[model samples]
Target chain A: MAHEVTVLTAGELRGLVQLDLAAVDVVERAFAALASGTVVMPPILSMAIPEANGEVDVKTAYIPGFDGFAIKVSPGFFDNPKLGLPSLNGLMILFSARTGLVEALLLDNGYLTDVRTAAAGAVAARHLAPAKVETATVIGTGIQARLQIEAAHLVRPFSRVLVWGRDMAKAEACAADIAERLKITAEAVADPARAVAQSQLVVTTTPAEHPVFKAEWLHPGLHITAMGSDQAGKNEIEPAALVAADLYVCDRVSQCEALGELRSAIAAGLWQGGTPPELGEIVTGRHPGRCSDDEITICDLTGTGAQDTAIATSTIAAARKAGAGSTILT
Target chain B: MAHEVTVLTAGELRGLVQLDLAAVDVVERAFAALASGTVVMPPILSMAIPEANGEVDVKTAYIPGFDGFAIKVSPGFFDNPKLGLPSLNGLMILFSARTGLVEALLLDNGYLTDVRTAAAGAVAARHLAPAKVETATVIGTGIQARLQIEAAHLVRPFSRVLVWGRDMAKAEACAADIAERLKITAEAVADPARAVAQSQLVVTTTPAEHPVFKAEWLHPGLHITAMGSDQAGKNEIEPAALVAADLYVCDRVSQCEALGELRSAIAAGLWQGGTPPELGEIVTGRHPGRCSDDEITICDLTGTGAQDTAIATSTIAAARKAGAGSTILT
Candidate 1:
């Protein structure tokens, strides 16, 4: 019972993995599996620690034909910034589906989560966004904003990138970082509306309590991927913009209805009483995605345990083949 | 951060831990924390695999003022024995409460679960059972049957032990093992009623879907600890027997009402309409346990997350102090 369990730290994971379009394909397949009703994804177990302004969520999914399942414990302590600590950190425990034994522990400190989230955004953009883009805008200076732009590049190559944040200095720094990382002309933009109107693609990656941009900022043929509204009361897209969109898709309709931008739209009395097709349906050829360039398309990604499992499974496999992680008996 | 986490395997844990009366006291403190509204125990996340006749449950509790919290993944594959594997297997992942970091991994393979369960049974008996006992009966020749009898020895010094099982060979073997282990005059008995009539205490531990003993088999001063019905449909004590008992309690009143002996009684329309005081209440001095020797007492144990957290925290502390287990960066 004291068999070796592979242990991959965040730095080790970051060194060994570069999640790009190919990783998006992995997430797409996971979405298809979830849509096929062959995966067992339990409702998240969430606990709140109001005293510390923190919460932890446990998510996992057992795919019918997969070799491993992942149980991810993601914690967010909103007050950690003042203490010189990252607000988000957690680990994933991967188990063998056959024997239910611990296969690996990914103490990635949310590195894998960022990778999967970015990959999921790329997958959605690939299936739903416009084919060509001269300009793109990212509404946040956080880690996800940079990752989303990188992920969005896998779907649509953009020349000029507009970065926005509450703090203009951080926004300028993020723009410099984006320009260096993606090798593009990136600039900090204070006007969210102007940035939105100039770009064909918009990715909002903020923990905003209100809409990131006004609904009127949406332009023709624009596709948006809102990736920040995974929790209740978090909104990165206006409700009116969602109603105005021609095709609305989400990572998981149930999750969206409960904790995503869809929940906000529903709360605003703007959403129609019909379930939109999930992103998986489009990926699996069950529904048409991005019918016309003029059609306003949006994909609400509230995240899924399937993506977590998919990424964890692939990470462990890659780490083992590369001999990138240490092993210890537990 | 690649901090070290103590890893405790099943064999190592078994060698170091003896969960008897003292362990019961540990569990009692956890129950007190739970009852005092200081522990954050979330609803269990459960998933089922119909094809494998299996289910996995993730349970956790964050006790206030504790150093760490434990998330336990308990999976039961009913068809495992066909492949030379036990039906239940899983591990606990303990996280530091302050930083939400990995503290330890207890790969106990259900050893800790079994220990906590036996300790709970002992706690119940210590508070509710008759003080003096010449004989005690245990139904079912499973691992729990052995553990429960050993656990019961902490509260009452029985001179003789009776073991009953459906299979005569297993029953006789279990009795012989008990005699050798506990050094009591033990014998296998086919007649559960006859065994109940002679013994002052009864501990039922089986995966029985039906009642093990009838209500008519009960005698005055008989105290029973039922430890089998943890699922919704499994019962080892008759509803009538529960109704006839003078005092009744369970590890958790809510859990008992949903999946323990109390559920069976309520289904049969025999339970009185009120929440029976929990064992925690009695342990916390809020409720009187056994008042008279002639009054029959019964306690049902459906298990709790608090006990898991307590045991895991204590185990990790001990392992660190004893320099046991392998440490891995997570």
Candidate 2:
């Protein structure tokens, strides 16, 4: 039987979907599905090409009740920047959950991943951040830095934004981009500790090998979403920071233990608390997320296949509604 | 940077590549690369959708010298036949190993997979089968059953073939097809034990939950390639069969332990040998294969990501040479 596969380019996807409340809601629903205990998400299939300084990760999940599931291939070549190319780019293929047939090919070039990842930050902040936030800070000066602030602003309505990175120029550029795009007060802070001290919500988006945010900087009424540590050896928050937080939550405990900030804490013997509650549990009201306004909470975002499936499904639906993308019969 | 992705439909792919000597050589090179100890092939990422009685597996590998690698998504919906659809259908994505950019999309609907799997059987037969074989038997009436006979014929030049399956009618049909295609005498045998006893080479290609071939059927100078046990709980050969064989090899030992006939042997405590030599080792001359024509041999093939990568890379090259795909810029 011939099957029609809709092929959407990055430009088409960007025009169809954005890091908005709807996207955040889609990701939040995915978290709820994860909490429902029926989603089948396998461990990531990762391959490292050291010669090219590149790594590719394949992630997929089957979410019940969804019409389709997505298999996302994300490739990151750190040395690509030297060749005047972006460090990250990849695609997603959505297949029919009922028939296991290819339904669409999304050549988002990492745009959907960026949106879903930032939306996850938004979900974490929506449940854990202070009720009212005046300032927000994002560590790292990548595309995620700008998107993270925009996503957090959707829920927190922060008036000011601070961007911190090792490269001051890149940080300034990221802050400028966020300020112009969101029409909010944004500045690049020289010291990460100072940025964390002044903000009610902090989102770390770096792929740093060492902690970029310190535990001594932890303050009351602060909510931190550490999303940089998706791979082992990539740490953005100090191990002690998780211990100092009033409550530590993660997208998935098992994933976080191996690939997130939890990995660092466990290796340092600082995480005596057994298996912290997942972000999904808090989203489902199974666990109270933030007890009081003074509570300092941290949510580790190692990323999940559920989010990829969710965003891909939502994007395909939106594209169908918009009559976007070219269809090829195979 | 803009990139062009070549998309090849199943018909296009079939036109460009075939299960010939070149294809077998490509797979053989992949096995040799596997033995080189430099290939990076991660564990398969599999998800089961029980509601649809379906499962999807994602596999990939990075061979150092290959210009590109493949990430294959294979979906098997067992109930699809009831819906007038094939049980297996999926695609492969070839990406540039250097820059991490997608180069081609192969919508072969599992044709490439079938060819590679059958070619692996030929690889085993080439190194381990008796010096000359007049009769070969395939113990399942599926597509692989026919292809395995064709593949083994490339190595052993078998003049006669036997088809055995639980369903006599289907086995007769498979035998007729093989006879017409290979121009060899083919007959459907009702008894599997009798078929194995008469054949010099036997290939099991069924998704049976229990042993379909028994250890009691083992005979000197006979070689068996069991390719159906690629999933846990799926066994084609009995546990004692490995112990009865003078030499037992596998595509990959760790995979065989988890998802092949070796798993059953280890569970039954019938296999005392620790880590048998891989087929790749024999291909690379690292292990002596087939000490004598009278030595019974068994090769458990659970499949590997390296074969997928090798076939994808070769297919893309062939497609490019033939100019047989649609190129879309993204």
The TM-score leader among the candidates is 2
- Candidate 2 C-alpha lDDT tens digits along A132-219: 8999999999988888899999999988999999899999999999999999999998988888889999999999999998999999
Could you tell me which residue pairs clash in candidate 2?
none
Across B1-330, the per-residue lDDT of candidate 1 in tens digits comes to 456666777778877678766677788788878778677888778777766777777888888888888888888888878877787878888877776767787888788888888888888888888889899999989888988898888878798999999999999999999899999899999898899999899999998889987889988999999999888888888898887888888888878888899998999899874788888888888888889999999999988888899888888877777888876654
Q: What share of the reference contacts is kept in model 2?
A: 0.81
Chain A TM-scores, all candidates?
0.97, 0.98
Clashes of each: 0, 0
**Each model's lDDT:** 0.85, 0.93
Chain B TM-score for candidate 1: 0.96
TM-score of the A chain in candidate 1: the value is 0.97
Q: Which residue pairs show backbone clashes in model 1?
A: none
User: TM for chain B in all models?
Assistant: 0.96, 0.99
lDDT of 1: 0.85
Best by DockQ: 2
